[model samples]
Target: MNNQDDIILRTDNLTKRYGGVHALEEANFTLKKGEHVAIVGDNGAGKSTFVRQITGVEQPTSGDIFFEGKRVEFNSPLEAREAGIESVFQDLALCNDLDVPSNLFLGREELLFKFGPFSILDEKKMMRKAKEVLERTAIKIPNLSNHVGDMSGGQRQCVAISRSASFASKLIIMDEPTAALGVQETTQVENIIRGLKDQGVPLILISHNLRQVFNLVDKIWVFRRGRIVGEVIASETDGNEIVSMITGMQGGVHEKASYI
Candidate 1:
């Protein structure tokens, strides 16, 4: 087992409920420093619900979240981002009317005068920083002036990921990042994910594609009926075993993979 000091994120008995519906229950999860982990489950299996709690999109009914070894309860997604947890939700979250640079610095725009809403933005500086971020992630975009809504699906996805890569200091969480892209576009996004791994950034990916999960992450966590059913080392397990865990099929391995 990794030392406690090596843990980047952890949750203990995290639970969320709405009236009689329990969206997530007793989720105990962890991600080690520089490790990439995938969360896989079928629809309504509490995968996104778990992510919502971690990213501060919604508060849990009861739980504890530890980041960098410190307990925290973020009041909002903005607070989570400010605390160095960046997320690329399935929607991409880019403003349709904004150009590349503007969207890259959306909520955290670079201001010239530090005035509240009246301050003038340093467009040139923001563009330069955006370029550096894209270059570092090896993302190629032809024009910075193009509106995000006008770009291809893959390019827009890259923009969202680049925004996260630029600002995330501790960890990155991605939900269905390549769900709607074509083959080439999916490849592009996957390559960017690999780039993040190469940079030693810890990531928690929520995906349905077992192939992609095996390709990109070091470990997999399976969720079933609002609970984590199993955890496995990606290299030590196969898709069949993961599928059985997800579906709870008979004669399938349900035990956690040996980490030692």
Candidate 2:
């Protein structure tokens, strides 16, 4: 909020297109240090598309991304993670067949030997570390030996979030984190989000739940028709104002369309 130095992430005219159809167009957005912001809109409003671009799941057609005051163009999700950006998509991306520890250390497994493909897994060590991560995030999974597929939806969602929180050094992004969850499960996930805020970790949450958005984030960014239409402080705005922006009915209809 102070200046560019205070910004953890910033995008200048970020755009994405498929043929002539623009999924996301010139979306200029920002997140400051230790701030939580939500992206809310109707379907096809470009929330996920914008997130995909930021997480390096897809390259932007044209834009400059600044993270921690340095310009960066990530070629893949791996690159983005290495640069301290971790994302939890809707799929959760956990290995269903693998047990909790294995899923937690899926790609970054510990090895007893220095071998590549033939390396012996240090299963005990990975399990210990996984337990530590779960504890740190206040996530409870009774048995670390249980296959992730055997767990309930909420536990699996917690695992995905725990994994992201454990490794995210700079920023964490969540897309529809609680869309598939029920009331109890949603509360569990929301508590985890609050934990992230307590740690002062900056986050970008994409959610359609205005109630949840109002409860969690410091600011709300409304997207309409592939473009970022408006931003408002969460404490100062209500659901109706945000709904108006999403439906292009805030200003006159044509006036809102002018952003596109």
Candidate 3:
């Protein structure tokens, strides 16, 4: 990555507090267009808060968020989505009872006006779009009408990812994307992530799985005590060092906690 180029998103003096608890503290972060960045930390280390601010799921008590070189304040996640930011949370926001295509095009449904002012959902068009989007990531769904509840964990995750890719124009943030999957399923989801990367959609991945983080992200940012402790390029660091930081054995400000 070059020091001089376009930046898609950045934060300055970002802070978030709940009552007296600081979830994020004066953290500065950046994401370059087409870059895949991973954030890892132990529980209560502010990973979720950081992503919440970035995705506009929660407002930062203080700080300015920049998107595509312009300062913007997002009041809600919908605002962020309108600005071309899509997120896949750990829950994936999937509808268990709905079919794959329905879940894929959930909120943003297509409307057809066969009668003026009395429009109905255009299911065929949405199904076609769903199939196309799923294919973009090489996700093989034998039937688009299958209920998501019946799909394998990996397939459900892929559907969620595909939905984000289908809607996101600039960035996608995924939180604990493969947390409940088996090894094979996790790899399937990782391949979908790689496909997203190849297509130039910058992604922010929030995961505690160091091995997955190392294998998928180009860079890793470590968080401790609601603050960013360090940022390391994947080529320059390993999971053991990051895990040590997460446990406070070693990092920006703590170096004596104990790695052994």
lDDT leader: 1
TM-score sort, best first: 1, 2, 3
lDDT of 1 at 151: 90
Instruction: Give a tens-digit lDDT track for model 2, residues 75-143.
Output: 998889889999889899999999988887777789999787989999999899889988876667899
Candidates 2 and 3 compared by TM-score, better number: 2
Q: What is the Cα-based TM-score of model 1?
A: 0.94
Worst 10 residues of 2 by lDDT: 251-260
RMSD of each: 3.8, 4.0, 3.4
Best by TM-score: 1
TM-score of each: 0.94, 0.93, 0.90
lDDT against the true structure, per candidate, is 0.90, 0.89, 0.86
- Stretches of candidate 3 off by over 4 Å are 1-5, 114-118, 251-260
Point out the higher-scoring one by lDDT: 2 or 3. 2
Cα displacement (angstroms), candidate 1, residue 133, comes to 1.6
Give model 2's TM-score versus the native structure.
0.93
Worst 10 residues of 1 by lDDT: 251-260
